[model samples]
Target: MKKSILTFSLAVSLLACSYAQNIVDGNKIPVAGNVKISLPQGFTTAIVAENLGKPRHLTINPDGSMYVKLARAVDSKGVLYLKDTNADGKYEVIKGFGNYGGTGIYTKNGYLYTSSNQEVFRYKLNANNEVADTEHPEKIITGLKMGRQHETKSIVIDNNDNIYVNIGAYSNSCQQEDRKPGSLGVPGCPLLDSAGGIWQFKANKLNQSYGQGTRYATGLRNVVGLDWNNTTNSLFVMQHGRDQLNTLFPDLFDAKTNAELPAECMYELKKGDNAGWPFAYYDPFQKKNMLAPEYGGDGKKAADASYINPVVAFPAHLAPNGLLFYTGSQFPEKYRNGAFIAFHGSWNRAPEKQEGFFVAFVPFKNGKPSGNWEFFANGFAGSDNITSASQAVYRPCGLAQGPDGSIYVTDDKKGTIFKISYNGK
Candidate 1:
């Protein structure tokens, strides 16, 4: 027992030393405004890969290799594998495969799973955790409902061999006339019957459909960012709130109120949980869930008691595209078991300056948020006040943690992979 303890101590010491060495040797990359990603005092960032394609969701293997899913196919390939041939902390070897395109990619249980808009597929990995057969991935789930709005499939897998898939609602608020001004919300929101929720399926099952799985939660407008919290044994998701509040109900909301009325919410979910998307939205100022205007709400009415509330409510219009729970040791002690979210920036907050083009950190303890959320990384928008989406330089879309506890954020605009590391203070 003493010998075993001594060996474990030595291995941890060696790993700590190696981690420090990598930080000292890694190149510091500059981002927007010539600023180096404005991290907390002790951390630094580097660009490991750049200018590939429209990289969306990302997953880092235990061996430090990365698999990135693309929003659009590059040269007919939708997935890219990146590896650092040398120990220089730069991914030099790039390979692409899988002809389909979507926003979900994950590595788990000897398989690398990816999702198209309508299906989930997995490629078995080899002994090295690399894809064994990229050309022939097993279709795990198929025939998911798809539409024009929020069609990307975001996915998360739990330790219990269950996969959670997000099926976003196509309409803004399940209106009688979609996106039409002054249109009333359809009572009982029929869209929630099949979309606007998370569905669970067997991770290894082949060719499964909607009828084969169970609805895990409902009433979310869209969930591009979600993760299974291994520490709490629960699922957490970020919901994109309904849009065009002021335009749809001008008498109830002004432009400024529209910009900040609905709060982007993070919810710790369970079976049969409802967030009241078309009927209610979180009002950060009121600190309560407000009734949505389409449901006869005049902007001041609070929601009923049946809907679940968010654990964290962020500024309205910050499109949270990715979320991750920090289980890494390289960050400070406050970060462990906390959540990291990537805000893809807003396109609709026009009369007001755009917000949330950065990464946010929410500290949690014992399955609940213990501290105030703060920004961990910023300056991805390249400008402080964004009036248009095209004016932004890079939009952060995904987050992943490396085996050595480093954090990676992927930019969907330029396909840049930014690696962030911490050097002890």
Candidate 2:
């Protein structure tokens, strides 16, 4: 971790222009004025739009229009429809609609789908593949539980027309008293009954409820970032690991250990797979799943193998907000089936310097990770040192690929939309 930080810092220090070539991917990514973000070689970035009011998740249409679900609504409308009238690749025309604000937005099966904190809705598309009826969207799924904590309902759709939604657990760790020191976990976490996992429903079905949907997997505390990996033909999700280990269980772990112990896990989920949360967490440093202190195990004891392991584990609390599988042909061949994850960065890595305000790449081949994760984009924090998230200039919360094989990323803080494209070098 120290080596990765040092290398990234050195790269940032050396670059002195509007763009710099990333040695990893050999792409010349852009570095806008005062904003310190960077991308790989041959690839370039442009600020396509700005000030859209905290855009969360986004989707790009075949006609080069875009829809971003805002974290907060503007003028009673939550979704922003951006149109690129010219072929210069900037979304010059922007409009807003949809009465509520939330984290999920997607386009699938000739419809544009979105979610609020508690419901999933879809709008029909016309011949242009844009939302045909913005004012009257049909409710596809209803009555989703929103506990007001970890309650972002991210949405993903598979090729089979099954739409999966993440129902985040309300409690931080299912403790008898949440976030309090020495509080034991509840025996049978009731939170998992109605929350804490992904639920699957028919994308074409309307007005589906919990009884109508299937609990595809269980024991995920909260998942903000998820996508349908077509190459693997499976659902992949990013679980936000449980927090406050040192503050809650002071004797079991120290501040440094608390900051780094449990990994933010990425699981390639199948039907009935449980990536154990609240009960256990993956220790990336130890490379094993450790039993939670609330579950009556010492910090050193490993969790039982009944729980599924993550395909990859990342540094904890970086807030993995968006996940996209690269199927676009704009980049070199090495990036074809790999994954790009945008980290919203960390706030609680305190007592140590906060990290991870950047986009990361994990190379994959034939549906499996082939190499270690590396920073494909970096420097969103605006400085090498950051003790608080509010000090960071931009937070990349969402990702989408365009029809021309370029990619777009969203910033929830400044509401900036950036497009990264290949120059075909």
Candidate 3:
């Protein structure tokens, strides 16, 4: 027994050494030094941490510390506090808080806020504005509905102390039969009453319910990415465009059209705003909200003017999951006030090579989108083309900007955090 135990310990030590040696040798992993991610000419990239288990949204503190939310609990711990004590651009100190997990997390005013799929909570902060009293967090909002699809609750807090949460529609198209081919859309989609929109509740208020909240916007199918744009003092969101355009309506749409129609859109939201969803979709090619075929559209008719249009539109099914407005001066001047969106990449664009497993930028001027959106960083997937989601090496999931103007990205697949900085090359 003693010899067996000794052998096992020696084997474990050898394995650890081999892994560290691989990293030192600049092999493909530990993924920090030579991860194959491509940034702009003047920017450099490094993996901040890895093996983080389904990391979701992340926020950087004023002091460059970070708080990340995981999609599920790890050893009953969901929230992570990370610190880079040595200033080596790698986070070395890691701490865990609360045995709950969800997709929303942020630090503001004097507290750290996080959420579960069906509730939102806040923890008091220490003097340094870092996490404190984590285990006994106060529940700010409760009783939210989370279904099987689009169940993650992404969150953002505004300047006025209002917190916004997305309640995604569970059904694919609000169809009468729900994704059944040839089924018509339910008129006046009842799902809009509860899901399919953003809701506003007081950030300081405790135990709030859906009945106590106000519907800020309607007709957004599923908004996984949203941010409070301080420049405009309003809410901005990226709507994941609906799917199966050709699979459901083969008579009207072809495989190529299904893969590329109905653009993923970015919208600057205001009170009572409505960005059309089940009833209509924005066609990037036509630059108009085309009536949905499920709603009697023959693939060409435009929806009425009652629906609000998007500020910017991207290719279909790219799954924009993170949004950050650059207020830092790290990169070139063009990046200031511009928006960085992390496309989680596409799983539905079958029969066509997938794209958008990278961070994209949309330049903004005077609080609105100014120029066309472009690729800010690429190569997250480690290849030029991929036919499926499993082939993706790292899917960009969340984004944040550090105090020195560096940007951070999170991957849900391997739970990796990547940091990108401008070196002024």
Kindly indicate the candidate among 1 and 3 with the higher lDDT.
1
Candidate 3 segments exceeding 4 Å error: 1-35
Worst 10 residues of 2 by lDDT: 15-24
lDDT of 1: 0.85
Candidate 3 lDDT over residue span 1-425, tens digit each: 33443453344335323422211112122243334765556677788888889999999888988999999989888999899899786786478987887999987888888989999999988887676677689999999888889888999999889999999999888999888888999999988988999999999999999779999999999998899899899999999989997779877776666777678999999899989889999987668998999998866689988999999988788999999999998789999989999999987766768877888888899998888777777778876679988888899999998988999999999899998888877
| Each prediction's RMSD to truth | 12.0, 5.2, 12.6
- Estimate, for each residue in 259-351, the C-alpha lDDT of model 1 and write its tens digit: 765889999999999998889988766688888888988766799879998999877788999999999998989999999999999977768
Sort all candidates by lDDT, best to worst: 1, 3, 2
Expressed as tens digits, the lDDT of each residue in 1-425 for candidate 2 is 44443443343234311122331344434456676556666667888988889999999988778989998888988998998787775686466788898999999878999999999999998888777568899999999999859988999999989999999999999999888899999998888988999999999999999769999999899999899998889999988898988788766666666666578888999999988887898977567888999998666689989999999988778889999999999888988989999999997777777777788888999999998777787877787688999988888889999888888889999888988888855
Residue 292 of model 2: what lDDT?
92
Among the numbered candidates, top TM-score falls to 2
Clashing pairs in 1: none
